[model samples]
Target: MALLWSRISSILPPNEEQFPLQFSDKVESSVVEMLKRSRRQLYCDTTSTSRMLNAQIVVDISWERLNTGTWRDVDKEWRRVYAYGCLFKVAALCRENPSEDEVLQAVRTCDMGLLMGAAIMDNILQVLVRILQSELRKTAKDEDESEHVEIKRAKIVSPHVPSIKEDLAIPRMKCPSLESFNTNHLIPLKPVILEGIVDHWPALNKHPWSIDYLRSVAGCRTVPVEVGSRYTDVDWSQTLLTVNQFIDRYILNKDQTSQDGGKPLGYLAQHQLFDQVPELKEDIRIPDYCCLCEGDEDDITVNAWFGPAGTVSPLHQDPQQNFLAQVVGSKYIRLYSPEDTDKLYPHQSQLLHNTSQVEVENPDVERFPEFAKAPYLECVLQPGDVLFIPVKHWHYVRSLEVSFSVSFWWS
Candidate 1:
């Protein structure tokens, strides 16, 4: 317990500057006082639980206020509240004789703070969480290697799907030179699949992204997952689940129905999972092609797409160029030129203006007559393939099997 406390305390910012500089002194002082009060309560034998619940009430009020504001307009005080709550949970767990469940609860608290709080004040929480993650991983590894028990993995049966025709396939290149790629694809704003480029990525070789490996590293971390067949569905919603829970429920037991007795699909789509789990991020590298963009290299956005077979990303056009790298499994992708946007029938609402209402695989020809006339290039992206999608190119993606893909978006 003393060693753990020392490690956690080593990561904390100076007492004089605990919060971000943008926050008012009032906010900093208030949060500091709250932490001091919580620490005192935690050390007290009679009032620890009651005081912790009261502190939680205060944090909940700030959380509700945080949700009421727009994304860019969120109040900074709410971040302080979340950070304080995480610190309180850490203090509670550092107390003598904490249970495994209590340690996990502390980890979850820190994760939630990272998910919702400002990054500027998250150093302490991040370090604390990583230390706990290492401990959890070691425990899991020990359990797996224990001689008293046997560990077995369930047999995975992949569903069969028809092969796509290659007559109108996207052009494929094998590690073309920068000048060649720029002249042939970038300048012409054409899509192409580049091979031999990502072949050396650790994700494809040294640190292959196998199910068991992913579970061992990130199984305990919580992540946001989309629940439904597709985002365009009326029933679509998002929920947070631990990586292991998601794997067990969605990847391993795809045939099982949801708790509500309905077959609900789970897709971990368009998430900055790398930011949450740095170990997974180390498996892949940003392609050199991204340097051709006009914006600063740091402006590039990386997103992860992982889900079971049959997951779909409805036809949509992004505002920036994208390099969709296939690390595991395969996907059937279709791309339409921006000139055919009207034929794709983008949704009228501003919220969905970038998304086409028409389903690429099963379109209603009568209602969307122009879609049938829309000429598009298609391809089957195999493992280690990097597909370059030009800006504003309408694209649709469907996983052919359980898959994990990384996309880098840059101007």
Candidate 2:
């Protein structure tokens, strides 16, 4: 055992020591300034910063100059260096903060997990958090005042958007037959509400998924959550938090102000949550209509949409046919056919081509005059309702209450 330990120690790099090394004033100051600047850049325009955070940093290296397989080795070595580099940046940002709570928040930034997942899994994240906490306490004691003023606690304002009484021109039926729904809606790329479709699902009554029930079942489980009201917002970001932490901070901690000066809205959107929490899958049954798809019913993709009120999925279209089952609360859904693609003004970026650039509720007529001519279908999906949205049908969804929805996508 002693010989094995000695060999392992000899092979490791000096920087990979068992304990962290102390940095000189010059080194620490430079790293601190760089980290602060990086933080400002990161939040300045989150969409661009997200790309910067996750984009691979490539180093120019000629394979011709190295021996066979040596280039591969060099690539792997640099990749590992890149990962550590990200962790160091995160740690520096955390350490420079005078508030312990702010330090924790910095570590919880949505892209941080993507940037430093390997470090977190290796317990390096815990070490960094502890170091940051220690440094923050020391700084607080040394300085007579905090670096910035903290907001006083207040009541959490409701972020819910009240539903408008608009004419819903779409068809709404009570548990329509699979054949009729497929022929009348699916084949024609139309949207329809099939009420009572999910009435038998345990989630509706037999096994209700209330806040207390969710906390009791999967409280400590870590899941990725959206931190802003809508993805289209400039400040929108993602973060990994436990079910309990999400409920406490976003659901229970209403006094907290969001970056947009509104209540922070956390949403667990478009995630294969049933796969993560298998127990929850048993609560809801797959709609029989899913069998109509060309592929096997089991092959259908299932996702969970759980979030507080006001959470929105900006006007977007999915590539596959979707069965959105509303189990708890209600959501306002608006749809437009693919034929209106030109009028809707889809985003120029290929990545977001499926999404619309217009804000449906409040469109800038001068900027998007054509948008007014596009005919749209609307509906309020209540509990026990399953909405059939045909493939490539542009749709916008917004939660009206503390909501839980399950979506199934298939060809």
Candidate whose TM-score is highest: 1
Candidate 2, 1-411: lDDT as tens digits: 112223222322333333332333433354434434433443333443342343222111111212235444434333333334454445333332224554444334313333323333254544443343344434443312321111112122333545545575568888888789878888887788888878888788787877756754455455788888888778889887777678767755545754356665888875546654556888988898888889896789989988866778889998999999998778888899999999988999987888999998889899999999998888877778888898999999988777789999999
lDDT of 2 at 395: 95
Residue 335 lDDT in candidate 1: 96
Stretches of candidate 2 above 4 Å error?
1-167, 258-260
Error of 1 at 307 (Å): 0.3
Model 2: residue 97 alpha-carbon error in angstroms: 36
Model 1 spans > 4 angstroms off: 1-3, 13-22, 25-32, 39-55, 141-161, 258-262
lDDT of each: 0.78, 0.63
Instruction: Show the colliding residue pairs in model 2.
Output: 110-238, 156-254
Worst 10 residues of 2 by lDDT: 56-65
Residue 277 miss distance in model 2 (angstroms): 0.8
lDDT tens readout by residue for model 1, 191-302:
9999989887888899788777787778888888998878998999999988878887887664486434667789887555887788888888889888898987679999
